[model samples]
Target: MHETLEIRLTVNERSEAVRIEPRETLADVLRERLSLTGTKVSCDAQVCGACTVLVDDLAMSGCTFLAADADGRSVRTVEGLARDGRLSPVQQAFIDHAAFQCGFCTPGMLMAATAILEEHPRPSRDQVVHGLEGNLCRCTGYEPIIEAVLAAADAGTVDEGVAGW
Candidate 1:
């Protein structure tokens, strides 16, 4: 039998205690065990940023990140981007700016953008570009995505009371 570890973690604001193998990746636990499939796994090497998720409000690649490391930490997925049925400002900005196609990279891109906004609420255009460099969009939809991020910043949507994210 594979040695397992019992870990307590908060995901999407819900608390859960789960048994997992030490070798398992956060993406595997989130997708397989927690049924949070919004965090897509691609390139599995932490290069594509497709499996990006937030651990303690910091963006990380779930695919390569160990699940055990997330113990006692807060994990946020793309699904958490909506609150009370309203999309987070970054997600809404993605739609308003038509920043997604094929929808593969959107989740990672959104999480990354959320991290950016959390750090720099009013980042410049170049800053947005640099922040998203780790994420790869196979749909080649960068312009609108960039515009959406910029618009979200311009609208000043990342205040504490405004977004529970």
Candidate 2:
């Protein structure tokens, strides 16, 4: 039998404990164990940002991140982007701007954008581009995504409450 380790972590502002194999990736744990499928797993090499999730308020590639590494830390997936049924500013911006095409990369883009907004409450266009450079999207040519980030910043939606998760 494969050895398993108990992992305790905060997910979407909720405390959770689960047993996971040492080699399991964060994406597998979140999707299989926790049932948070918002963080997609693709390009297992971390080249595609589909598995992006926020770890301690920083954007991380869930596909390549070990579940054990996330123990005792906070993780926020796409499912956590809403509060009390209200969409987060970043999420709203994506919808308002229609930032996604096929939508396969939306989750990662949202997580990365949220991190960017938290780090730079009022980021410039160039800054927004630079912040999301790690995340790739084959749809919308990125113009709408960039616009959405700018719009979210302009709306003053970046707040400490959103960053806490």
Candidate 3:
């Protein structure tokens, strides 16, 4: 029988305490336990970036990250991108630019873009490309995504209303 470990963490600005198996990944805890399914799981080896989530404001692969490792940390999933009822700048930019096709990679892409904007508020085209290189999208051909990020930056919405977590 596997032992369950008690962990306390913050998700989407809400505090949570959960009993999870030590071997459980952050993706499993977020999706199955916490009911936050916005974090997708693809290429579980962390190569696809489909499971990207923000831990302490940095992009991390949820599928490869242990839930226990999230104890005392703040995790932000795609579902948390919007606050109140307004869409985040990145989300809006993606929509305005038609950055996604199948939408399977949208969540990770959004998180990655958010992280990039946070790190480099005015990232150049090459910087945006480099920042999002970890995420793989079969649709949109990457141009729309880059454009969306740039748009978000240009609109000055990338950092607006976003907490420092």
TM-score-based ranking: 1, 3, 2
Give one digit per residue, the lDDT tens place, for model 3 in 1-165.
Answer: 789989999999999999999999999999999999889998999999999999999899999999999999999999998877878888989999999999999999999999998898888999999999999999889999999999988766445545441
In candidate 2 the C-alpha lDDT for residue 85 amounts to 88
Candidate-wise lDDT, in order = 0.91, 0.89, 0.91
**Which clashing pairs does model 2 show?**
none
The predicted structure with the larger TM-score, 2 or 3, is: 3
How many clashing pairs does model 1 include? 0
lDDT per residue (tens digit) for residues 76-95 in model 2: 99998888887888888899
- Give the clashing pairs for model 3: none
TM-score list, all predictions:
0.95, 0.94, 0.94
